[model samples]
Target: MNTDRLIAVLAADAAPVGPHVVEWRIASALSIAACGAVALLLLSYGVRADLAALVATPIFWAKLAFALTMAGAALVATARLSRPGVAVGRVWAALVVPAAIALPVALVVLWLAPRDARAALLLGNTWRTCSLNIALLSVPGLIAILAVVRSLAPTRLHLAGAMAGLFAGAIGTAAYCLRCPETSVPFWATWYLLGIAIPTLVGALVAKKALRW
Candidate 1:
């Protein structure tokens, strides 16, 4: 076909697209995964017995805030990455903000604590299982997030995967909080962060093949 003819045919095939619904789709997937995760939590690790009494404490909310904040940031980044060539301006900063805020606070808390107690602050009794549990809990959410991302056109496959993992990990941590007895910010900053990193690394490694179109 002639160049002009090919151009005309291509133009004729173009159609107007509707508003994007990436958030809704991702939310639906995450919601489904969250339900499964909740079930897992109920069966394997029920909520802390003192949840009712701890509800009024600032530390409890702090734990929730850390997870939710990172989840929000990761969600924004994942949405921006769903499109091709879109600049996710400062969206990644959201991920860093939580750590930035938490680090300083953790530092201060440690500074104010007695030298003998610093070790306990850093490694709570559940240190051996904390990160592992977070990573394990993230499995369902990771599957959901990856499935949602797979349906989209992501040029940066690895990054999209990592962001999805971040979202999943945070959600998992939040769920784990229901049973997590540790209330130390330092512990959350260290171990919880490691748990989230596990999925992020896995996503980055597998996304190349999984997201290949």
Candidate 2:
């Protein structure tokens, strides 16, 4: 084929792309997913009975801040992943910083308590259920996120899926916070993180097949 003719053919078939479009697409999809998750949570587990009192405590807000901040970071990462030729760079720092800060703080909180009380801090009554619930809640958000990512030109499919999963997990964790009665930072830092990790791992594994254009 002549060079000019080949170039023209390629250009014609290329997908249209724009700056920051990924952010909006993923955000819109996740917002819809959040509504679905909330409805599911309400219908299934219902909100905590002491929600009003829990909201008054500092720990409650701290737990939310950890999850929401992770969501924001993952969203940024997913946005970067959705586009080709984009350098993720320090955007990953947003994810690392919160966990780095909170985990140590949680450990300290546990250490300062009486030795016998440490187990309670680590394993709260819901440890077995917490991660599973977070993963389950993340399903709707994960599907929504993958839909948006699949529409884009993500070069790193696995990373894109992982970030999307992280985003979904964080959102799910935040929603779970409303129903969770545990007040220990150690419990949240451990179990909640495990919850987020489950989907992240799954996303990484399935991205090649699921995100193919």
Candidate 3:
């Protein structure tokens, strides 16, 4: 067969892509996963009893801000990775900014506190279970987002998987804030980071196989 003839034949039946298809699909998948995470939180842990009081506090908002900002950043990175040749560039800064801000604030708070009281700030009441719970909440999002990525054309499989996992973990962390009574910045800087890391590491480890084309 003539090469030009074959190329023309292949192009003849190609369909034009609809606008915002990738964005719509990924957003829809993550929305469903967020709902799942919320439901899991309600069923398993319930909201913090003093939520009404906590709602008026600045620290509560700060915790939510950090988690959600990280989520938004991870979503952008994962979306870029989903395509074949898109440049990721500085999208990672979004992921770092929240943590970067939180860490310095945490250190400052720790430095100002009495030495004996430092442990209480770093290890909140639920430290043992917090990371595990956040990782558990991430499962639904991980499965959902990974499925979305698998259907797309991600070339950088490991990075894509890690970003997806981070997105899931960040959203899960935000949901967890409702049930978590820890009011200390140091605690969030430590345990919440561990929670997010759990899934991110998992994604990197599994990506080569899970994201295989």
Candidate 4:
């Protein structure tokens, strides 16, 4: 290679990546994973048998993965929005992609699961229980996260929001487990899926609006 070209290539390769982006990504991933794991653990181990199945099944795992991924994307978008030159529309568009992918996947997975499995999945009673639980768990955390973001301008608001939702879902699941009589895997699976989905949807909506600069 020519000397000038070699120097230019080295400079490009040695360029410093932004620390904020790295911190944002790591924080987002860890926050979501930790919150989701803690919630699921509590529901599965601390709560009754009815709650034990909350984390069971491919569908639940898939949704968790999807929700966390979206949450990460939302955080990235939020960080971008905080920058002076970035466009809000672009950030919003990027944040929406995960939901677009997850909604269809959720539909198909739920539709394809065996009838008994579908039954186990909570649509009516479990759905209602989980929704209430999610709301209770999420509300306070959401307030705290929004406050922190407002004051400190952390780039991980989306991650914080996701953790809040996951914690809420877990606590909510624990509450529902105490009240629920159903112990079957299918019931827990169904209801748990709903629980995760509801918060994920709500988080996405919040991110769309709140993450805007």
Candidate 5:
């Protein structure tokens, strides 16, 4: 009841948290939410009917590579930002490398395509809904990741939130690939990028208030 007694009780209840705990928490939260996002996508959009045929295509793998690589990089950034006083450092390179490789390849592919096909490559059939679908699928992840970060010790609220958003958005885009029938490199590079960007921007905007300790 008294100050001295309360101090003793607090000391007795405290336990030392190891570094592995942090990794496990973030990894588990993201993984679980990713599964949910995929399920949500499946329920709403259904898997592409020709997924088996698409699997053998290079473009399918390329699409996965883009989203997965982005997610991996964002995971690193999110991990670093979850802790106080941690610098992002070369995680920026990890994040940029995917775009650096994918964008150039996309541009080259666009250049060589027939003029008429160029429009399809950029817009695809679902251009109106592609980014929106990805963003919607990411809701589960965004909520879960933010909850985990809030429970941890993040000092850079805005940056931390933005990184979390990017991570979730990447994962969402990856899930959306299962439903997306688009075969254009340019479309992935542009529309998928926008999907992830939407969440990242939203995260940064909300982090200051939502992540405030």
Candidate 6:
């Protein structure tokens, strides 16, 4: 086949290229930060307790850090996929590696702890509360992220999986709030993290494959 025809065929098989990577990254970062800000605001103005202590705690900060890091990593993968000549399979693999390592480690750590300690770890503090708060704060932020991703990425595969994962996380968080009593940081730091972060990471990985053109 001629060069033009060959190139066209290859392009046809590739994922739809959407927005500039940098812009998407910035938008995602801003959305996450906004969520955190809203969470803090709710804690201060709406909730009964002292926001200062909750925000200051190492556990709360750690959860924030983890969420931000995962979001950042997903954005990076998305950006990398925007470049020409990157394989979809390779991008998916890149996204999965860290997650595979982290998931097992998190599970093992939780499993190894004594039963009472584990329960205490998962149910003791403001995890459920913060998760509910975070989930509530996340709704608008997540919607914004979806809109940005749709506008920029526009690929059906990426959009569908990402939105599904996001919706699932939001719903799960809501469910946890209804059923669970404890709302501590450790509770969210464990089960809640797996619930939201895992799906999000999976969505990002899928997006890398499906959105690439």
Please say which candidate is ahead in lDDT: 2 or 6.
2
1 against 5, candidate with superior lDDT: 5
Give each model a TM-score: 0.91, 0.93, 0.95, 0.45, 0.93, 0.50
Top-TM-score structure, candidate number = 3
Q: In candidate 2, how many Å is residue 100 off?
A: 0.9
Q: Model 2: per-residue lDDT, tens digit, 104-140?
A: 9998998799999999999999999999999998888
* Residue 158 lDDT in candidate 2: 93
lDDT of every predicted structure (CA atoms): 0.87, 0.88, 0.91, 0.49, 0.91, 0.50
The TM-score of candidate 2 is 0.93
Error of 2 at 28 (Å): 1.3
Worst 10 residues of 2 by lDDT: 15-24
What would the per-residue lDDT of candidate 4 be over residues 1-213, giving only the tens digit for each residue?
999999898898686667675446445544544455446445544444544565665544544454455455555554443344554455456555655665565567568888776644435455455545545444433443343344334354555445434433443443444444443443444555466556545654675456444
Badly placed stretches (over 4 Å) of model 6 are: 1-57, 78-114, 125-133, 159-186, 194-213
Report the error of model 5 at residue 191, Å: 0.3
**Model 5 agreement with the true structure over 1-213: per-residue lDDT tens digits:** 999999999899798888698899899878866997898998898999999999999989989999999999999899889889989999999999888998898899899999998998999999999999999998899989988888787999999999999999999999998999898889989999999999999899999877887
Q: What are the candidates' C-alpha RMSDs?
A: 2.2, 1.8, 1.4, 10.6, 2.4, 8.1
Which regions of candidate 2 fall more than 4 Å away from where they truly are?
A: 9-20
Name the better of 3 and 5 by lDDT. Answer: 3
Task: Decide which is better by lDDT, 5 or 6.
Answer: 5
Clashing pairs in 4: 120-186, 120-187, 121-190, 122-190, 122-191
Ranking by TM-score: 3, 2, 5, 1, 6, 4
For TM-score, candidate 3 versus 5, the one ahead is: 3
